[model samples]
Target: MYINLHNMQAIIALACGVLILIMPKLLNYIVALYLIILGVMGIVRF
Candidate 1:
């Protein structure tokens, strides 16, 4: 499968944002992890 990791990460981030609205506790970890992962993906070009 030709899956795009960047797009996948974006989708995950979007989902996390929606989830965060329901559960504010996840805001820190989810957004932090998503940003870190997305940053790495962008820098490394994966």
Candidate 2:
């Protein structure tokens, strides 16, 4: 039950990729949100 940032990012990215493949229209939002989240996580280091 202990996940590091890199692992979390990979999981999220994988989920997003699957979602994009299914929907195709959410590519922009998913990528943007992913970047924002990754940036925040990187800065906060939480």
Candidate 3:
């Protein structure tokens, strides 16, 4: 099961979306983490 970077990101986004729907409060943390991850990925170019 080799998942590419894009697929992994998609799965993460889907999970986060479902979690946000279940617990709206998680939105803040999820968004924050997402942004942080994006920044890191951008810097690392991965």
Candidate 4:
């Protein structure tokens, strides 16, 4: 049961997209956080 953070983030981002379609309020924070995390991960080569 060794789940990586990147995989977890992707899953969360996907879920957030679905939630955003329903609520729409989560678009900003969820997408922002996902991009920030993915950017950091790309820069850090993780």
Candidate 5:
């Protein structure tokens, strides 16, 4: 399956939201990692 950039980001955001809801303590790390990954992906165009 080939998912587009928007869809992939949405999925990741949703997953991170769920994880944050489940474990509030990880909210900071989850958001940070998500942003970092998005940045890297944008740079690499992957």
Candidate 6:
């Protein structure tokens, strides 16, 4: 499949959602890491 930005983002979001549901405590870290990675990706245009 031709994976694109939206698809990748959706996958990341889904993974994070699952993690949050599982831990319920690492939510802050998960979200922070997600945003950081996303920000880096955006800056790199990846």
TM-score-wise, the better of 4 and 6 is 6
lDDT of 4 by residue, 1-46 (tens): 6779867876786899799999899788877887897799899995
Q: Evaluated with lDDT, which candidate comes out highest?
A: 3
Residue 21 Cα positional deviation in candidate 2, in Å, after optimal superposition: 0.5
Could you tell me the lDDT of residue 43 within candidate 4?
94
Tens digits of lDDT, candidate 2, 1-46? 8898778878998999899999999999998998898799778986
How far does residue 43 in candidate 4 sit from its true spot (Å)? 1.4
Model 5 TM-score relative to the real fold = 0.79
Q: Can you give the TM-score per candidate against the true fold? A: 0.59, 0.79, 0.85, 0.58, 0.79, 0.83
Error of 5 at 32 (Å): 1.0
Candidate models: Cα lDDT each? 0.82, 0.89, 0.96, 0.84, 0.88, 0.91
Ten contiguous residues minimizing lDDT sum, candidate 5: 37-46
Model 1 lDDT vs. the true structure?
Answer: 0.82
What's the candidate order when arranged by decreasing lDDT?
3, 6, 2, 5, 4, 1
User: Which runs in model 2 stand beyond 4 Å of their true positions?
Assistant: none
Measured on C-alpha atoms, candidate 5 has an lDDT of 0.88
Give the runs in model 1 whose Cα sits over 4 Å from its true position: 1-10
Give one digit per residue, the lDDT tens place, for model 3 in 1-46.
Answer: 8998999999999999999999999999999999999899999996
lDDT of 5 by residue, 1-46 (tens): 8898888888988998899889999998997898898799878975
Winner of 1 and 5 under lDDT: 5
C-alpha lDDT (0 to 100) for residue 31 of candidate 3: 98
- Estimate the TM-score for candidate 1: 0.59
